[model samples]
Target: MHTAKILIAYDGSDNARRAVSYTAAMVGSGGNRLVDVAAIERPADRDLFADDAAWKAECARRIEAMRTSLNEARAMLVAAGVPEAAVTTRFVESCRSPLREAQECSIGTSIALEILRLAEEGGYDTVVVGRRGVSKQEEFLFGSVSTKIIHAAKGLAVWVVA
Candidate 1:
C-alpha cells in the first residue's frame, strides 16, 4: 500500500481550522499516512510612518501568532490518532514582489506558488487547503488563496475544504 502524504495549508482562521479537522478525519482511520501543516505569512504592507524595524517586528508578531495556530493544528491531528511524529508544521515568508513592476505578484499568489513548490519537491500526493481564510473582505475584493492554488497546482490533487 502507498503511504499518503498530505499537506494542509494553515493560518489562524475558521476556514483553516476546518481544513485541519477535515484532514484529521481523513487520516485518523488510515495507516502509514502523514500530514504536513504549513503556513505562509504575508509581510505587513509598508507604511509611510513605519520604518524597516517596525515592519520586521510586525512580521515577527504575525509569525508568532501563527505559531499558536500551528500548535493547535498539530494537537488536533495527534488527538485524532495520527502520531506526533507524523505531523510536521512549517512556516514560510511570502515572497516579496517589487512595486511598480509589470510582473509583480500579490502575497497570496506567492504563497500559492510556494505551496505548489513544496508539494512537488516533497512528493506530496494531495494538497489540502481551506477554501477561504480569515479575511472575508479581502477575499470578496480579490478572491481567495485556494482559488489561486487551484489554478497553479497542476498535475496534483487539491482538496479544498469549506
Candidate 2:
C-alpha cells in the first residue's frame, strides 16, 4: 500500500477542529498514514508596532499562539487513534506571495498560500481545512482561505470540513 501524506490546516476554530476530526476519521489508525497539522500565522506588520522590540515581542506572541493551536490539533488526531509518532505539528508565517509587490500584503492570503506551499514542498497527497474559520468578518473582507486553497490547489486532493 502506498503511504498517504496528509496536511491539515488548523486554526483552533470550531470548523478547523471538525476538519481535524474528519481527517482522523478518514486516515484511521493506519501506520501507512502520516499527518501534519499546521497553522499559518500572519506576521505582525512593522508599521503597526511602535518599536522594533515591540514588533519582535508581538511576533513571538503570535507564533506562541499558533503553537498552542497546533498542540490542540495534535491532541485531537492522537485521540482519534492516529499514532503519536505518525503525526506532527507546525506553524508558518503567511507573508509570502509569488509577486514581489504582493509579498508584504498579508490580508487576504491568510493560511491558503502557506498551506499550498507546504503541501507542494512536502509532497503531501492531500490537504484538509475548515470550510470557514473563526472570523466571518475577515472572510467577508478578505475572502475565505479554504475557497482560495480550493481554487489554487492543483493535482492534490483537498477536503474542506464544515
Candidate 3:
C-alpha cells in the first residue's frame, strides 16, 4: 500500500492526544507518506441580533484558540521525533454545524462511496477522529463529530481513537 495520508482530527482532548501519538509513531517510522492535523472549529452561536463587531471578535478568538491547539499538537509531534516537514496543519470551520460540516467536508454518507467528497477535495486519504469530544455530554452521549464522521465518511477509512 502507498504511504497513507493520515488526517488527525485534533481537539486538545486526551483522546486526541492519543491519536496524535499514534500518528507520530505510525508515520515517524516511515510507514506512512504524510500526516496532517486538522482542528475543526465548531460553529459559532447564531444570534440574529448579535453585535456584528462582537461576533467578529469572537470568531477571531476561536481561531486563535484553534491555532493554539494546533501548535500544541505540533509540539507533541516534534517531541515524538517526527520531522516538522512531515506534518502539516489545517483548520476547517464547522460553520453552522460542526458535525454536519465535517461530514459534508468529507465523503457523503454511504457504503459504496469510494471517497469522502471532502477528503478527496482536500486530498486526505484517511480521517482520524476521537471517540469522545471536548464536551462533557460527549462522554455520555456518542461524540457528535466522531459519530457523524464514522457514519458519513463512506469510502474513506475512519479511525476512532479513544
Candidate 4:
C-alpha cells in the first residue's frame, strides 16, 4: 500500500487534540507516512476588537495560539506512534470574510475552503479535523466545520474526529 499523506486541522481544542490522536493511531509509525499539522487563524474584523492596538494584540494572541496548537498536535502525533521526523507543522492566517461560509450543508463553516486549499496544495490524501472546535453555545450557533469539509473535499478522504 502507498504511504498516506495526512493533514490535520488543529485548533488546540479537545476535539482537535482527539483528531490528532486518532490520526496518529491510524497512520502508526510507518517511515513512509507523512503527517502535517496546521493551525489556522482567521483574523477577526478590526471593528470587533475596538481599537487598532487591540486588534493588533488580538492578532498576536491568535498567532501565538496557533503556534501552540501546532506544537501540541505534533507532540500528540509523536506520542501516538508516528515518527517525530515524519511530522511537520504549519500556521496559516487569513482574513475571515473572503472565504465563503458553507451555507448549503453547514453553519458558520467558512473555514473549510482554506482547509481544502491546504490539503490540495500540500498533496495530502487525507484531511483530519474535529467535529466541533468551539464551545456548546458557539457550536449551537455556528454549526460544524466538519460538515463543510466533508462536502468540500470531493475526492480526498476527510476524517472528522469526535
Candidate 5:
C-alpha cells in the first residue's frame, strides 16, 4: 500500500519542528508520501481602523511575514531529509469578516474547517500540527483551530506533535 500524504500545519513552533522531524523519519524509511506544509494567515481587521492605506500596508506586511515563516519551515523540512520535490507549501488567509458572514449565511466556516477541507479536497490522508502555535499561551487550552481540526477531520488521522 502506498503511504498516505501528510499535511503538516506549521507556525514556526518547536512542536511543528518535531512534526517535521517525525515526517522526515517516516520518509527516510522509504515511505511513499507527499508532504505539504501549510500556514494560516489571519486577515487584518478593517474595523479596527478607518485608513485604507494603512490597512493595505499592514496586510502586505503580514503576508510577507507569513511567507518568511513558511519558507523557514520548508527549509527545516528539507534539512530533515524530505525531498524538496516531495514537499509543497501553502498559505491560507483567514479573515474574521468572511467568517462572520459565513456564519450569518449558515455556512459556519473557520480556518480549521478550511484546513480540513483543503486536506480532504487534496486527498491527503493525515494531518499534523503542533501542540501549541506561535502564541504559546499558557491557558491550558488547545488552540481553537487545532482542536477543531482534530475533531472534525473524519477518516483522516490527526497528529499533534509536542
Candidate 6:
C-alpha cells in the first residue's frame, strides 16, 4: 500500500497548533501514513540590529524558539495517536540568496516558498498551513503566506486551516 505523506507548516501560532491537531485526526493511526511538521526561521534583517553580535544573538534565539515549537508540535501529534516514529519534524533556516530575497519581496515571506520546496522535495502529496489573514493593505504590501501558497501550489493538495 502507498503511504500518504502529509506536510504541515507550523509557526507556533494558535491556528498552527489547531492545524496540527486537525491533521492528526485526519491521518489517524493508520499504518501507511507519514506526517512531517516543518517550521522556518527567517533571518532578521541585519540593518535592524545595532551590531553583528546583536544580530547573531537574535538569530540564535530564533532558532531555539523554533526548536521548542517543533517539539511541542511533535508531542501534539503523538498525543493524537500518530506514532512517534511515523511523525517527523523539520526546522529550516530560510536561505538568503540574492534571487530568493527578490522572490520574497514580491511574494510572501520566504517561509511559504521554503514550505513548498520541502513538500515537493519530500514527495508529500498534501501541504497544510494555518490561515493567518491580514488586512488588504497589509496583504498588498506584504502578502499572506497562505494566500501565496494557495496560488503557487500546482498539483499538490493544500489545506489552509483557520
User: Which candidate has the top score in lDDT?
Assistant: 6
The top-ranked prediction according to TM-score is 6
User: Can you tell me which runs of candidate 2 are displaced by over 4 Å?
Assistant: 93-110, 133-140
TM-score order of candidates, top first: 6, 1, 4, 2, 5, 3
Worst 10 residues of 6 by lDDT: 97-106
Off by over 4 Å in 1: 94-109, 133-140
- The C-alpha TM-scores of every prediction are 0.81, 0.78, 0.70, 0.81, 0.76, 0.87
Worst 10 residues of 4 by lDDT: 99-108
Task: Indicate the worst ten consecutive residues by lDDT in candidate 3.
Answer: 106-115
Error of model 5, residue 104, in angstroms: 21
lDDT by residue (tens digit), candidate 3, 58-162: 766776787888988887887777777778887665445323434433222221132244467667778876665447776356436666667777556787776
Kindly list the per-residue Cα lDDT of model 6 for residues 1-162, writing each as its tens digit.
Answer: 888899999988888988998998887786678999988766677788898788877767776787898999999899888998999997665554222322222122567877898888889999999986678999899888898889889779999897
As for TM-score, the candidate ahead, 4 or 5, is 4
How does model 5 fare in lDDT?
A: 0.72
The candidate with the higher lDDT, 1 or 6, is: 6
All models: lDDT? Answer: 0.80, 0.80, 0.66, 0.77, 0.72, 0.81
Error of 3 at 148 (Å): 1.4
Q: What is the lDDT of residue 15 in candidate 5?
A: 76
Report the Cα RMSD per candidate.
5.3, 5.2, 5.9, 5.9, 5.1, 4.6
Superposed Cα deviation of residue 57, candidate 2 (Å): 2.3
lDDT tens digits, residue span 89-109, model 5: 987665542322222221225
